[model samples]
Target: MRQSSLTGGAIMFTGYLLFFIIMRALGLLEVVELRAINFIFLIAGVYTAISLEKKHLGWGFTYFQGLGAGIEATVLGVMPFAVFIFVYLSWIDPEFMVYIREHEPLGHYITPFMAAFVIVIEGCASGFISAYTIMQYVKAHTAHPHE
Candidate 1:
């Protein structure tokens, strides 16, 4: 399970970094609406983790295991991604960071670390929800063979 999720999480982080970097290069990073697409990457990563872990566990796969895979993938993936964002903002693109401060609600209170923490919370929550929703469909397929 850990190995599967580590692979999936690495893929997820790469996807996220490339996407954001491309968006930044394209001068679209400021488009807050596009941030929603990040969830798609998140969903994909969680699904990959759960599926791989399920296969590895074979008849032992369970709902809890699936949930754990999802959570693990997101945490492992998002933590470094958050770190990258913090570095990008704090040094690589302070101007954009300033722009975020000006545009966001309670903008004055925002910091790079705060933003990264929010990503962790949001990514984990979204990952859990994705897992639950996915398990609702996948659980039937993953049931114990003897059951």
Candidate 2:
């Protein structure tokens, strides 16, 4: 489980990083339109991890196990990205931070720490919801005979 989670997390992190770089290179990083689209990778990562767990467990996989795996993968995967965001905002491009502060819908300035916190919180929430939703299908298909 640990191995799969770590591997899946790495995969997720890589995918996100790649997309971020691409978006930045294309000068679309600050475009709010692309933000939601990036979430597809996040969902893919969690789903991939849970699917791998299911494969490993074969016929005995359970909903809770899938949920746990998804959560673990999401946390591990998003941590690196969160750190990167902090560093990027703090050093690489403080102007982006200023832009965000100035145009934020909430009308609140976000520090680097706040940005990281929001990322983690959002990732965890997405992970939890995705895990629960995905596990419903797994649970239905893998239910035991006695149940």
Candidate 3:
């Protein structure tokens, strides 16, 4: 992987993990309640990813560049999440379907695909905001001690 890719991935993953633990500790990880929080973390993760990417790549964050970076980070960051769901919900969670049927029943309403689709939608929203903000921040900051 490129330097920016590795850095962005590491930063995004670590940040997400930390936020996950904190939210879980605060009892806000109840899938239903934490949906929004997860979105926020997505943005934050993207923001951090872009920041690190810009620093490593030494590229200015033009609109297109930022958008591309955000999308890349979002896709990479969410890859693990998708795999996790597969493993946990399909292979590990003994009560995955039961819990889903009870808490997020959708056959009578929305389908399971819709529920999963929400994750991608939320990721897009968060990624856009995060990329914009992080790029702006990096653009504004100057005189780095290391540089």
Candidate 4:
């Protein structure tokens, strides 16, 4: 379970980092803010982690196991990105803050720390929801008649 969670988290982190870097390089970060596309990648990562856990456990994974794995992977995966965002906003590209303030709705007075806080909150919420939702399918498919 630990191995699966670590591996899944790493995969998730890598995917998110790559996506962010590519989008930023292409100057699409602002345009893609808070979009479904980001959630797609997040969901993919959590799903992959949960699937790996199932495979590793080979009929031993329960609803809670899957949910826990998903949560672990999500938190581990998103931490680095959160750090990156904090650093980026604090040092690397302060101008991006200005851009966000100008373009984002209700972003007129948002600080860098506030942005990072929002990211963490959103990431955790998404993680929990995604984990719970995915585990439902796993539970339905794997539940035994006798149990």
Candidate 5:
């Protein structure tokens, strides 16, 4: 909704795309375990957005503001990445889809849309959690308006 959140989301999106491309280039895209590392990028991006918003608001920063910025950044960052994944699996390389399907619990039920949808859900939850946790430290250091 705000510039800081948008910028943070952009950073997260860029990192997600770049990392995926790098993994694909290295032929390690299939290494299921390595995907966990993407969470770090997500956390970093959310932190950046919330921190920026805090600075912008100065002593006016509030819990809700941080939460919104974090969630907005996460959604903005993840939506495009999910689309990219959907496109890649659906058109660029159906084999990857097959690979993912085979590795998933309900292998037969998995689809490109499902995969992308999962990312969206994960991103939103992660964003909320990340924001809440980060706000603990930030709120502690910040001078509350009521104070």
Candidate 6:
């Protein structure tokens, strides 16, 4: 279970990073604002966590248990994402503020609290979705066990 969780968390982080990079290259990264991303994470994370927990524990979902798992996965995913975002914002785009201020009207007024909320929501949703996907795949393969 622990191994699966770690693996799933890693997969989620990598998948999201790749997605972000692709979106950035296409100049659509901003479309996934922190808040919207976070909201998606929360919804996906809950479902994934529940599915994974049931697979490992043989029981249905519990809010506390699922939340704990979701948070753990979220933390793992965030550590790398934080560094990635910092690198992109700082070294990659020192002039990002100016561009954002001019092009993105709301960029200057975005608060730290808002960013935090978005990150939290993103982490939760990503974690859950990853977990759910992992479980589904595992179950499908197991059901059609190879000789």
**Winning model by lDDT:** 5
Q: Which is superior by lDDT, 5 or 6?
A: 5
Local accuracy by lDDT, each model = 0.87, 0.82, 0.59, 0.81, 0.89, 0.55
How large is the C-alpha RMSD of every model relative to the true structure?
1.3, 1.9, 4.9, 2.1, 1.3, 7.1
Q: Is candidate 4 or candidate 6 better by TM-score?
A: 4
Worst 10 residues of 3 by lDDT: 107-116
Over 1-147, each residue of candidate 1 has an lDDT whose tens digit, in order, gives 499789779878988999998997899987989989988888889899999988998887888988888888888889999999899889988887799899999878989888888888888888889878987878977656676
Best by TM-score: 1
TM-score of each: 0.94, 0.89, 0.64, 0.87, 0.94, 0.56
- The residue pairs that clash in candidate 3, if any, are none
For candidate 5, the lDDT comes to 0.89
TM-score of 5: 0.94
What is the Cα-based TM-score of model 6? 0.56
Of 3 and 4, which scores higher on lDDT? 4
* lDDT string, candidate 2, 69-140, tens digits: 888988988899899989998999888888888888863658988998898898878877877887787777
Worst 10 residues of 4 by lDDT: 32-41
Rank by lDDT (best first): 5, 1, 2, 4, 3, 6
Superposed by TM-score, candidate 4 places the C-alpha of residue 105 at a distance from the truth, in angstroms, of: 2.7
lDDT of 3 at 66: 48
- Clash number for each model: 0, 0, 0, 0, 0, 6
Model 6 bad stretches (over 4 Å)? 30-46, 59-63, 104-147
Which lDDT value does model 6 have at 96? 54
Q: Candidate 2 has what TM-score?
A: 0.89
Give me the overall lDDT of model 6: 0.55
